[model samples]
Target chain A: MTAAVAEPGPTDAPLLRVRGLDKHFGPVQALYHVDLDLPSGKVTALCGDNGAGKSVLTKCIAGIYQPDHAEFLWEGHPAHIRSARDASRLGIETVYQDLALADNLDIVQNMFLGRERTSRGLLDEDSMERAAGETLASLRVTTVKSIRQPVASLSGGQRQSVAVAKAVMWNSKLVIMDEPTAALGVVQTKMVLDLIRRLRDRGLAVMVISHNLNDVFEVADRIAVMYLGRLVVQGDAATFDRQSVVEYMTTGAAGRPGGPRAKES
Target chain B: MAGALPERAPDLTAAPEAIAAELPPEVVAQSLGEYVRAYTARIRAGESGVLPVIVAMVAIMVVFEAISPNHVFLSPVNLVNLFQQSAVIMVLAMAEGFALVIGEIDLSVGFVGALGAAITVQLVQPLTTNWPWWAAILAGLFACAVFGAIQGTLVTRLRLPSFIVTLAGFLIANGLFLKVLLLGPFSGYPNLAGQSINLQVVYYLMWGSIDPVISWIGAAVVVIGLGLFMWLGDARRRSSGLVAPPVSLTLVKIGLIAVIAIVVVGICNTNRANLGTLEGVPWVIPIVLAVLGAWTVLLQRTTYGRYVYAIGGNPEATRRAGVNLAVVRTVAFTLCSFTAGVGMLLYASLLGGMSNNVQGGQYVLYAVAAAVIGGTSLFGGRGKPLHGILGGLVIGGIYNGMYLQGLSVEWEYIVTGLVLLAAVIIDSVSRRGSSSGSVTRV
Candidate 1:
């Protein structure tokens, strides 16, 4: 709960490192020994085909679903995240594919949905509006006409930006975005991708989930691919070519694991 | 998803400063006047403000005045009676509207109203326990809330359809209404209630009028309060550097309210009754207006109210925002029932008593109709408490006009049915126009 203007400090250490994460729903195993590492000041892309344990792993990290057997490491120390509130307390924020925005609410209201600033037992509109405006300005999202308009009235890209702003406004250490640019038009998609790169440059750990390989290679500094219910390949973006990443996603085969993608001049 | 845009790499060259500086042609607002123009354009685009309902109300009045036998519909006495009669239904409509905003319905509200009235009367009467007026009112509302909680729990926990859970509530409450009279309080009668609630406080609710001096003072306070709230909101928005509506627009709104208040007070100040000129605003008018103002503030300024609207729009999104869906939803039902209790007490004031044979089911339908007519959608996420007020007035005007015209209940039903259909049609068509505009670019 610092003022939303608090600057994020750069930390080269791994901000979050989850190892041997496993989750099961009745008879099906959603995540089987999934592992991920998100270092501060870096953008890590999680790439996988459908039902490839990417969402399962992100949800586990977000504490939406408790992992059956998982060890969460925060700054190289063991941590516990039992619920969504616990995840928030640990500064883990997730923007799901649905954008997780109430379409009926305005931009300011959506950005500070549950965490409204209250003074004198009423929502402090002035503070909330200023804070939301500042957050959007920092992200350079100026296309929206007014902060008072409903999310339902916003364009696809603006909606996604609002969702991302909501996630980052609350002193989050790691941001997990599930398909931040999906369902957006050409120009809007570019805006969101740029916003993601801005997040990494600001020294915040960003984990983006995407099926599009081009989007991954463009903004992602590191790439992690999952197959079936397990992490098969995890590395920096330069270590793997587009075809190899696809191969890893579908067939869980790659030259190596747990490093950067192959760099090309 | 991310890099699907072809211009991604080249676009990254633009600094955040440059990006922030770029404003699309439509969004470059240079003046408050432009903002006002844009506001009207948006309403024309089908995101209708309250103007449509207001227009419809005016039309109803015009039509009724022309067709009335003696042109008595415009009589000040009829106008006062219409608003007073509308008071109870308006409350019920507001109650039903809360549930509707969340895409739920409380069919039990009508009978809940009956039960509340029955409980209120039983409390003050000699046959049962005698409580003070305010306590009796609170106790009745408490019962209604508890009953609502039961139905809400069943729906939320068991994953039952709200329609079914509240339908069960409707039946159970009706039976309880009769049972309360028979075994609990009124053992003298095994059938319908021949009882009347003659408590002076309850009796004078609608019948009472404020002194002329107090009425003027009350009207001044109300006008000033409204002006202050609207001005404060606008000033805050302007100071924050967000787009605020023009000062001219705010002044226009304040002026409109001032005019309406003066007219209403002037009309009510006339001596309609022959008994030494009974005048000034009716007590029920202020009571209803106060509740409406409070409810409006709750929905527009409070966190709980915002969450209610958000949950109604998309439950999944609200839940993902770390809101407790079950609790908010359950509270919504409780609030609905609580308001229903308030409406029933108003009904008792109008009727001078509670009767077991009251038309509870039909009244619930009327409440829903009023909300819908006022612009609340059945699908939820788009509504306000003001809908109940406007819609209630519409209903009251129609009923009062027809009765004055000597129309039968059958004709009343036919006309009212058509109006409800028209309202629903407006809701659906407008919704489609606004939503489909974005999704279907082709």
Candidate 2:
């Protein structure tokens, strides 16, 4: 593609727009006509009870599952993400809940796990170490003792930081984190929430999946709550309070019989 | 789930310079004293690395030297013979190291290796194929690699357990080895003692020695090269503000290498012959070292090696990283078998021929035992080729010392079995102390 073709589309458009996404497994429907918008430089929290289709939608966007019907607009252009590689090629990176880090490898090694840089058939350790350090520093993650420390030695927050740093280091335009702080302690959860805000401040589109509403309110600029395989409400963080969001999460609707369903962006 | 806000959110709006200034040092210190303290802390944390293995090795050497009949275990002749005898198992351990690092085991390496040795010996027989020594060796290694690929494919593609696949491979290879030895104009064995210069070179692989002068020169070159490589690389990383070992640590490591090389060469250069001047470094010693050096680089400096470790630690993570798990696993098996071929070639040289009577099963046990005793975690993702070398030496020392004491083969098995159990216990205990205890598999 030429330079002109490289520029995706208009700058102000949402970085990733998902419309009418549907997914099913045999006779069961997991996600139903899910509509979502992930704007750049903002954090959009995805909230749902278990099996409420939050993960199913994230996996669809991550190219881990083939949606039965979906329309994707990546960076303001119609794009197809058929594989995880395809999503990565489009500058979309996912930090799964498991963290997907090799425990035996050091921080730098885990950061550049698959896409390791090599020179003359040898791993360029110096360059990787420098780059990983710079990325961590940019994220203001100074809690870890050393980048060379093996991942198993890291605290839960430090591991999450490494995972996020890995995602952001790939020149990613959009980052989707699945429950970034599920198992973290108080201080560790604070560290990861701060990291999520930093990603948003860096002007990257961030989609966070979390069951913890406190973490959601701490970093999320916009929140989308799902129930029974449907997006009950999607709006700015200011539009909904904790009780409203919780009600929407469990009952598929907030206040009244026909309250605000899909508020204007 | 709701929770209270943090007591104080760290200042995210601070300048980059401010954050950098508050950052902790990558290493605890740059001086020798601080370096030792950090090392002790790490060891106490259960990341003792090769220290335990080295200590175990020294303990083995000391005990054997003190108790062997006439104290022959420490004699120069016996030491050199021990080195030669240990060569094959050391290489086999290295072969197993490849598969072990990838969280798999190649139970077939012993027989796979014997099959390769059989092929090499058969081809080099003047009355038969009459191939050159080098070509025959390559062919034999290739045969082993092919077998590895076949077994690897079954394990990776068919999703069969590696233990079962390689165990079946072990039986098939044992049968094939016998059949290959009986091919053409041979009975049940192929001897390497013939009128061919190629055959002589192959024989010299185990029985011959380098000239004293040449051995000294080679030792100097190796020591200097290795020392310079380590010192310069670490120095550059330190200068560039990267994570590197302390200057004192690098120098100490280099010094250790130099001391080891000098001692080994000095002992090997002395006259050990009761009748004539039959002293120099054995050819097999360098052969084993060369394999160790090459495999060390492959595992440490290559992307494939990184993937192997990653896969071993967490296969799902590796797959999520877009690494082809099947390909990496298959290649690991291939390299395992190929290295085993090298070990078997050395085995043939030591025995002076290839035959069906080789104890392939016992050798496989020795291979696993060596890797484990050398501090390689059987749980995977924590091993090195050097572990195989140290472990191999321990196995060889025990075997030689038992022979010196006139112990039966049964004792060798019993002692090795006990040693293997001790190693696995140490591994499991240390892992529990350091990380999450998930030792459900051997």
Candidate 3:
């Protein structure tokens, strides 16, 4: 395993470097020349509208679909992830919007699902339960009463937390969360936002894909805006103002030189 | 002061250990109470415990014995008869349970059993230039497995609902049965060869004393092996920091197995006849037990079993989990059909021949009912082959007891239908209650 080092410059070395990412379904290009860098221990937000290629980029990164043309770099080395399992093996975990949880299974069972620890054949329920409890608590998810409780019983926010905890349980280096708080109530949303911060604090690189500017502003260190298959802007979240982001999102040419842009919405 | 974003605080302190020592006592207590409530709710909703079902069956038997003035039903001979008669159904139920656990149903068990029997008889007949009985039996089982695999493939790969797939299988099997029978002089109906191959197999199996020592030993071995496996498995799990059933719970399970085994041996040892030379356990019992054991291990200990459960519980989740959903689904269907085939072979072995009116439909219904009653959820993701044994025994008891009372066949169907409906209703209600209760707890 490569040492997890924080990159000092934009071009120093990216943990995951994407160059000229392009995807086409028939004649419509879903992504075009999309270049981005996901550095270690930093939270990068991929922000876009419904059809602005946010999902396309996520799917490409997570190995759900192969990009028509692109290069994926890990530790400045070319990496080819053929499947989700391959991505997982490379310490890349994607938590989709659905959370992909088994509702009937309890927290411990869900947490250890597919990759359960077993002893002499039978499920090692106690160890998994203990580990799950530890993971949830370490992540400051104190809202859950029991690790034995079913995921279906949890609030949307708690479910999201569990999803993240599951990803982080296997020592994931990069956790990509797609709209972590989209369906959550205000309190639940706050809980999930706090979880995103906690993940970053744990020295894990976090990628949050969302259209909610408030959430991005609260938890993200950098924001990458995509519009109609091309990345329009990539900058530190602290440097960009809300008005300028909206301007870039609507019209690709924010304060930059001539660029094909969308009409302001 | 601009706040300076809290100065990007760096933790000079080492990271805390990941696992917590313990949760608050109140929370633990609350969670325990919730578990108890959920279990109770499930029981009330129609997830009938095996113990209760067994108790009810025994109680029904006692009641019938009391009502029959001649005490005919309680006669040791009749008791033994009950075992023999229920053996085929019990085996069929166990077979169906295999499929049910993976969230599929086998509707062709009855016809498949008939087909297997017909093949077995044909292969072993002297005029057909009889093959060794063991070899014939193997061929019969293999044929059934192949048949099942075909059905399984169609259902899994084609993405067809199992109900439709098996229903078509039921028809095809029945047609094959008639076609095979018509091809020979045994034309309209078939009988065992001049000498009974079934009786030969049964004699060899029950070859010892009035209380076959081998049978007793076999029963003891099964009980002890199962008990030790479960207990030790649980202990190892707990030691490794896994959630395991409490030690007391494990002991209770062992005790249940012991009791059931002892009772079965005791019943078999009882002298049921004043006339006729027949006493010890039937040859079919051990065979059924072995089949049950093998099926149980297959569904509980293998990656294939886990994939089956995963697919049944949530196919999309299983797919995302990187399991090939099609392969698992197809295999589950095939296993289900294969079990149906095994059930047919057992049926033929028990009866010694195939009949034109083999009650394929009726037996299929009972097999499904047995699975559901045994607590193998119709909606899937929660079941075991053992449930089929419990449920099958219950249905078998009813059939035997009712027939002994000289009850009409129609009445038997009515009773079975009522029981099946009751079981299904209970399943749905319990599932709903548990899900809702879980939501409340959350």
Estimated TM-score for each candidate: 0.90, 0.94, 0.85
Q: List residue ranges in candidate 3 displaced over 4 A.
A: A1-11, A106-109, A116-155, A241-247, A250-265, B1-38, B41-59, B62-75, B183-189, B193-199, B202-210, B238-241, B437-442
- Per-residue lDDT of A1-265 in model 2, one digit per residue for the tens? 2345466478787989999999999999998898899999999999999989988899999999999999999777899989999999888999998899988888889999999999999999888888888888888888666677677666677788999999999899899999998887787789889889889999999999999999999899999999999987888898777888889988887876444566455
Candidate 2 Cα errors over 4 Å, as ranges: A5-8, A257-259, A263-265, B1-29, B436-442
Q: Residue B399 in model 1: shift from native, Å? A: 0.4
lDDT of 1 at B34: 57
Name the best candidate (by lDDT). Answer: 2
What docking grade does candidate 1 earn?
acceptable
* Per-residue alpha-carbon lDDT of candidate 3 for residues A121-152, written as tens digits (9 for 90 to 100): 76655566678877877887766645665565
In candidate 1, residue A161 scores what lDDT?
A: 89
- Winner by TM-score between candidate 3 and candidate 1: 1
TM-score of 2: 0.94
Q: Is candidate 2 or candidate 3 better by TM-score?
A: 2
lDDT of 1 by residue, B1-442 (tens): 1101112222333333222222221233345575455556656555565667788899889999999887878888889889888898899999998899998888989998778777776676644565676777788889999998888888888989999999999999998877766644455232213343436776677677999778989999999998998899777766656556667777778999999999999889888896778899999888888778888888878999888898888888788877898998899898899899889888877877676777899889889988999999888887888899988888888888889889998887788788788788888866775564232321
Ranking of models by TM-score:
2, 1, 3
Task: Let me know the TM-score candidate 1 reaches against the reference structure.
Answer: 0.90
* Residue A47 alpha-carbon offset, candidate 3, angstroms: 2.0
The candidates, ranked best first by DockQ, are: 2, 1, 3
